[model samples]
Target: MGSSARVTEPQPLPWRTTRVVLWGIGLWAVALVVTLAVPALHTGDRSWWPWCCVAGIVLGLLGYSYVRRGRGNASDA
Candidate 1:
């Protein structure tokens, strides 16, 4: 409520975000395979699990591309 409010610049991430996204996508893929290969995992209550993994992969790809294009705070340095 005062004019003394200070806005600090965002600090850049110290690690590679694209790599992190790829790792997450890889883990999701592994989970998807596990859910498919294990009969009990994809049954009634959990049938939507595989689709979640697929979504993760799709979103991760989008994020990876965005970071690769220098659109995010992730530094390629």
Candidate 2:
């Protein structure tokens, strides 16, 4: 009797995750900018918009970096 090993194929990259994060960040940034530019829309809370925009930018960059790193590791493997 002979024993055989079964091989499985590698999974494909998750582009949806990357796209979602990118779009989420983009939308948030746009909203933040609009809110900041229009004082009437903010209803007297002006400071929050700038902070939100900055935070969104940082989060977006981090998400993008993570996705790229995952892709690099997958390719290396």
Least accurate stretch of 10 residues (summed lDDT) in model 2?
A: 68-77
Residues 1-77 of candidate 2 have per-residue lDDT tens digits of 47687778988766666687788888878988787788776666565666777788898888788886686344667
Q: lDDT of all the models against the reference?
A: 0.84, 0.76
Query: Clashes in model 1: which pairs?
Result: none
Model 1 C-alpha lDDT versus the unseen true structure: 0.84
Candidate 2's TM-score reads 0.57
Those runs of model 2 whose alpha carbons end farther than 4 Å from true positions after fitting are 1-15, 41-45, 71-77
Residue-level lDDT of model 1, residues 1-77, one tens digit each, is 75998899998667687788889889988988998999898889988988988898898888888877888763435
lDDT of 2: 0.76
By TM-score, the best candidate is: 1
